[model samples]
Target: MSAFPAQPLYLVANGPLAGRVSVPGDKSISHRAIMFASLAVGESRIEGLLEGEDVLATVAAMRAMGADVARGGDGVWRVHGVGVGGLLQPQTALDMGNSGTSTRLLMGLVASHAITATFVGDASLSKRPMARVTDPLARVGASFTTAPGGRLPLTMHGACPAIPLEYVLPVASAQVKSAVLLAGLNTPGITRVIEPIPTRDHSERMLRGFGADLTVEESARGRVISIRGEAELKPQHIIVPGDPSSAAFWMVAASIVPGSDIVIANVLMNPTRTGLLTALRMMGASIDEIDRRDVGGEDVADLHVRHASLSGIEIPADLAPSMIDEYPVLFVAAAFASGRTVARGAHELRVKESDRIAAMAAALGACGVACTEHEDGLAIEGTDGDPIPGGATIATHLDHRIAMSMAVVGLHARAPVVIDDAAPIATSYPGFVAQAVLLGAEAR
Candidate 1:
């Protein structure tokens, strides 16, 4: 395991956080924008793209694979695609760092092309499961020589004449769905994915916008997404909206902290990814949507959040796919609420960069919060108005979400909450500490 500073920062409960904050661009959309732009026929300009390490890794990989990609002024990135089936083999191993999304999706993109590539990553990413993408891609004639148990540090040999197959997602994962669709880009005929539970639809929406022949049909089982293979994708300008996941941290912090009211601007309110907003509303958060509009095919709105008395409610299992990444922060909200909050149908949490369910439970327990962790989910019991005793040091395990979640917990704790390592926060949210400080969160 990589070791960093375990020295903890103390957070004294402060007055209401009053400010307007704009989070960075969506990480998922940023990754796909780079990937799709590199595969399109012309130059694709992207504004408001996330420049985090994870997305930067995608940029480096694209450039290594012979795509012209560079950053211009003010979060603007330009990528010139070689064509649909025109990717060159990389000279070195593609390092995906801590991004599971990048690793899985890139595996799919390289799987159907006529090149061979190797993928490596940091310790946290090396442990993440790759079987989710590899198994499905294998069904469509992509071959992999992976590390034991389908971990990273593996080589993938793309099928020259790729096979097209129908895939039914075993879980509600946008990564899995995107992987199959990307691999199908170089194959012949229609490549279809059946998602019983819809995850984030950025890949589908963005793909359709890029001039791909993509179709979606709703059935009793779930949503069926079909993409025609071997079509030339026309590059276009893309404007990424602020990540709702990143915005969620500030929303939770502002809501539970007394006298706090904050507005997050230009947040993507895609229904497929708005379960946290809905859950917060159910728990008595005074949040309002204002100036709703569409930007680049995503629903954009300003969220007005104010402090209110919150009571916990059972989170529906069906909503897991929508806000999977927000659960750790949601657990923070649960700790400060009244009554019990139970989260189910989150077995996928175990396969993330870390076992997030177990990590959150352990960290919360360390901070004097009562929590019960299951194989898939957790149950958190709130102390009503009692301050959470937070004089504990929790191990972050090099997971960015874990670190950020623990920091959120510190906002309302009687004492300061300290995380063992804050280093991993750079993977997705590079300016997390600065942004949190601006929002009146104390982080050292």
Candidate 2:
């Protein structure tokens, strides 16, 4: 657990939410930008990076490994990279905070370099399994000593001239795939990954943007991605768009709260991250795309969402990978819909910051919403637009999405809902409550 004290937030039903708002930059892109820039041969400039604690952990880790990283008064971040295979051994352990993305991805980067580093994190992060990453890296000649259950507070000894090999993903995890790809950056020869199920392609896109010799080919087995190791990477300017995950809360909130009409600007519309938008649309949400365009090699658009009568529908299993992070809030939307919402094929949710399936089940039950938890997903019987009983203090379990999702539930509930600790929300959306209040929410 963090040393910080728990900060509770009370939220009650409010009037219509209105106005155009912008969320922070994409966390995934922000982390990648910092990482790729730190591996480039020259200075790289980044615009609109998310300053959240999670992304900052990546910044601090890169700096500790000899990258010159700083944010100027103009709010632009500049990084002077040490080049591929040039990372210096850190003087101390890398504290990853609550970012699993940072810990896993960085483990891959350090695997093929000639350095040894220790990684530590907060209690929540410490419990997450790192073996998925460490296992593949071990095959690449890197060695690790981890806590029991392959958890955090671990040491990794990077391999010099690491061996490159082809590996297949047993699960559909972008993090694991990205880890292997990143480790390939400093290895000799070519590293290949056979992905049976497609996940986010940010690493592939950003890697190419930084001039890494990476290629993707479709086949009967799935997508075969190959990256030539020990290649020179050139620095470039990067602009991060608004995170769709952050925008998801507003999308669902506006859908459930009567009379809500809000404009969310600069949200990334990458197909891999738009499953929530697609899912909500299937549930009869009134969301319109405004000025869809490309920004920084990715699709982005402003969303104009209005309150509509939502109907529960079976969530497609294939859509899980695209909107996994948004499930908590999606459940909130389901709670107010007409009919039943059944979600399956998302067993991956069990190992997140918390068991999201179980967390949402207990939270909704506390608010008098009926839900059945499954090993893979949940089945929720909606109130069909009626406000369910609230007046409950929800345990956030140090999970940001749980806190924010409950806050949304409070907006349409019969009574106020108290979040046990809103502090975790800062790890991703620091201004969530302030923005909620700005949109006419009765939160304090």
Candidate 3:
């Protein structure tokens, strides 16, 4: 199926960016809010929800299962749920457009419910690995008939009163962990997940807020999370904070671009998602925090970033689970630093919406930045704060982060940077072009 328009966008070197911007609500939390609210007994109200394509796919799927989900004129989303184990068998397939989270987590939610649902996705999502999720759900009595290699366009028949067991994660993935937890909500007995390394805890936090009987404890090995099944979730009023991942673009853009001073508002500063900030500070970025406070159940802050002469540093591998989504743009920041930057233990990038390691390496090579791609990471030699040669059109293989990362590349390049298609950005940040223009990015 066609993914994006075959159009190109050019970004010329802009002047200093000076402004404050509030990015959209956290995409991860937005998806969970819709899912959890749709499972609660009473009506749940949500504010600051991300209206991006990915989250809307979750809403559409939930609505297909008989939940009354709608946005009122007052700008609040209200969902009257069908309760746990009350999900109806969809009359048609769930078209999860370009969203791995919606597909995987919904599969878990649909598992153990005695319903048959078919799942399908766009070309890019279809190519992602699904065995990581399907294998675990299979152990819980959910049978799947998938495409080759356990990919999407598959049908799942969930078992009522499914069996529960403990699972150890071979890789660090919040998506997989969340899927199992969502599945556990409808099964009998206790389901346990032993994470090798902790990923984003948004699912755990949101699930707890919705009254799921879940507990997370740190053991010597890793985190052991146990959830009591057949949960009776109560409705909640949720106020989602801004996405730290989306604010990453501005963080990198302001750090390297000359004479730039920008502030990102209402950013989620949860410890699990602040790896990009920590890595940037290690590279000597001039970032300051103001008006820090707690909102809903997460930490929120306003970040004031100023242009700084950054030097490359070794990114800590332990921080990979926290900053996985921000690595592509972090690679862009590494391209402008003064020394060699080494990012290792991030093989997860290989399986993202695109092969981010390969994508960034190729894009940087086209812009005259020296980079070497490894099996797990990237090595980049920066230009010592000088403008890079960038008179090339980089191909974005339907990855939203790739397109946005290259947009930051144009800010410090000697020549304009052209992208093959920026339409994919609508998946996460719909107002990116306008935000970039407001922050002084020359685009046409």
Q: List the global CA lDDT of all models.
A: 0.89, 0.92, 0.91
Indicate the residue-level lDDT of 145 in model 1: 91
lDDT of 1 by residue, 1-444 (tens): 265544454454476788999999999999999999999988999999998889999999989898999888665798899888999999999998888888999999998898999999999999988998999888887788988889989899988678987998998899999999999888999999999888899999989998899999999879999999997999999999999999999888888888988999999999988988888888888999999999999999999999888898999888888899998998889998899999878899998989999899999999999999998899999978467998899888889999888888888888778888777888889887887778786666
lDDT for 260 (candidate 3): 93
Residue-level lDDT of model 2, residues 1-444, one tens digit each, is: 468788999776458899888999999999999999999989999999999999999999999999999999999999999999999999999999889999999999999999999999999999899988998999999999999999989999999899997989998899999999999999999999999989999999999999999999998999999999997999999999999999999998889888999999999999989989999999999999999999989999999999999998999999998998988888898999999999778888888888889998999999999999999888999999888899899988899889999999998888788899999999899999888888888777
TM-score for each of the candidates: 0.98, 0.99, 0.98
Q: What is the C-alpha RMSD of each candidate to the true structure, in Å?
A: 1.3, 0.8, 1.0
- Model 3, residue 94: distance off in Å is 0.6
* Better candidate number, 1 or 2, judged by lDDT: 2
Give the per-residue lDDT of model 3 (tens digit) for 1-444. 254357677766458888999999999999999999999999999999999899999999999998999999988999999999999999999999889999999999998799999999888888888999998999999999999978889899998989896889889999999888888999999999999899999999999999999999989879999999999999999998999999999999999889999999999999999999999999989999889999989999999999999898899999999999999988988999999999888999998889999999999999999999999889999998899999989888888899999988898898888888888788889988889888887786
Off by over 4 Å in 2: none
C-alpha positional error of residue 379 in candidate 3 after TM-score superposition, expressed in Å: 0.2
**Candidate number that wins on TM-score, 1 or 2:** 2
The lDDT ranking, best first, is 2, 3, 1
Model 3 CA deviation exceeding 4 Å by range: 1-4
